[model samples]
Target: MDDLPIIELPEPYRIDEAQLTDQAALPQLMEQRMDAALQQIEQKASLRTDRHIQIMRENMHKYVEDRFQEAIRGSDDNALALVRGELKIRRADHHDSIARSEARVVELVRGILNQYDSATRVRQE
Candidate 1:
């Protein structure tokens, strides 16, 4: 065994080169990859044990309901209507903020993937 010839393994391929050639395409590719990854993760995640998602949903609903109730307290008929309208606007704003936060999270995941690709390419070379 000590006299055996050492075989050189082939170098790993870099996916980053294709990515770098068309930087604009990177975001689209990353989005598709991230979407697939998230789907895979969702499929594998233990839904039965996912207490945080349920808790967060319940908390948000309770918070909104509490706010609406507070606004209507000691209010006349017209004031109640005004408060209800205000609650709707606040809910819409909250939804928009959630959307923005989700978008940011997606971007951050893509950034991490990009960094991983760069590091992998460097290591391969």
Candidate 2:
């Protein structure tokens, strides 16, 4: 903790194998360790996801352009209006879809953790 910059990590969270034998230390150890693990996972996921989102945005217009032109030809309405509307709506829809997909992952992680905790309690009893 001291080795790092001006940041002061909570002293209570320090992990020392020698402290594991003490029953009173378990809660503190678990809380600190779990928070650190979650933060690390979030950081890693953000880096990977940002790269993917950049690529998705770059390819989106090129990928959907042909379909948009076809749809514009088939419609009786204004071509300019159709183009503008589809671009706006599709971009928003794409963002929303990505959000929904990420939400499902969050839900699945919670569900898995809940099941594991329940099973652990049952086994302990």
Candidate 3:
């Protein structure tokens, strides 16, 4: 570090003798410097804020679309399962109806046969 060249630094600052005599000179200079420094800080903060807002805006549509797709995909299997369950119930009901119809036909045939037997006994007597 000692090998570094001896750099002649510039003078800090100087104001005209007439301006320095004014009581407001010191406060005005400080205010001007502070304003410049604050402007630089504000510019940097604005740039960062704008970038974040832009990124969020760009992704907003995609985010909403992804959520909708997930909801549909998540419910797809369940909807299919519900339809299948209803179909099974309908099929069972149809089979049960056919069985009841068959049983009624069998009962009617038995009653008719009994009536014929009674008629045959009367003819024989």
Candidate 4:
């Protein structure tokens, strides 16, 4: 209550002394004031509640988006690892194929050279 600002009443305000002494009407007047205060409080409470709900919804959306991005990153990493493994296997297979081809070529060349030497010797004899 100390934090509340003091409001100054406007000029031209006159109090009717008879209204203040009317004991019979005091209860009704008090009830009307209480009802108005309650209505104002309810309006403020409703506004605050709506604001809190909006904030919660926004937070939930952000959290879900963050989780989804994390999942995508995990999936991407797994896929990259799998591709690298497959590439390594294919490279090893290619190297083995090249080695086998080279061996076959060497064997064929040796056979051709031997046949040529035997033919030359027969001609000389």
Tell me the number of clashing residue pairs for each predicted model.
0, 0, 0, 0
Top candidate on lDDT is: 4
Model 2 clashing residue pairs (backbone): none
Candidate 1 local lDDT, 1-125, one digit each (tens): 99999876665644467657788787888999999999888876867447778988999999999988876774676787888999999999999999999999999999999999999999999
Error of 4 at 34 (Å): 1.9
Please list the residue runs of candidate 3 whose C-alpha ends up more than 4 Å from where it truly belongs after superposition.
1-51, 120-125
**Residue 47 alpha-carbon offset, candidate 3, angstroms:** 5.2
| Candidate 2 local lDDT, 4-122, one digit each (tens) | 77756687987666766666788888999999999999999999999999999879976799778877776746767788999999999999999999999999999999999999999
Candidate numbers, best lDDT first, in rank order:
4, 3, 2, 1
Q: Can you write out model 4's per-residue Cα lDDT over 1-125, one digit (the tens) per residue?
A: 89999776665564466756776689988999999999999999999999999999999999999999999999999999999999999999999998999999999899899999999999999
List the global CA lDDT of all models: 0.87, 0.88, 0.89, 0.92
Per-prediction TM-score, please? 0.39, 0.32, 0.48, 0.70
**lDDT, candidate 4, at 86:** 96
True-structure RMSD, every candidate: 48.7, 45.9, 12.0, 13.5
lDDT of 2 at 8: 60
Q: After superposition, which runs of candidate 2 have C-alpha atoms over 4 Å from their true positions?
A: 1-84
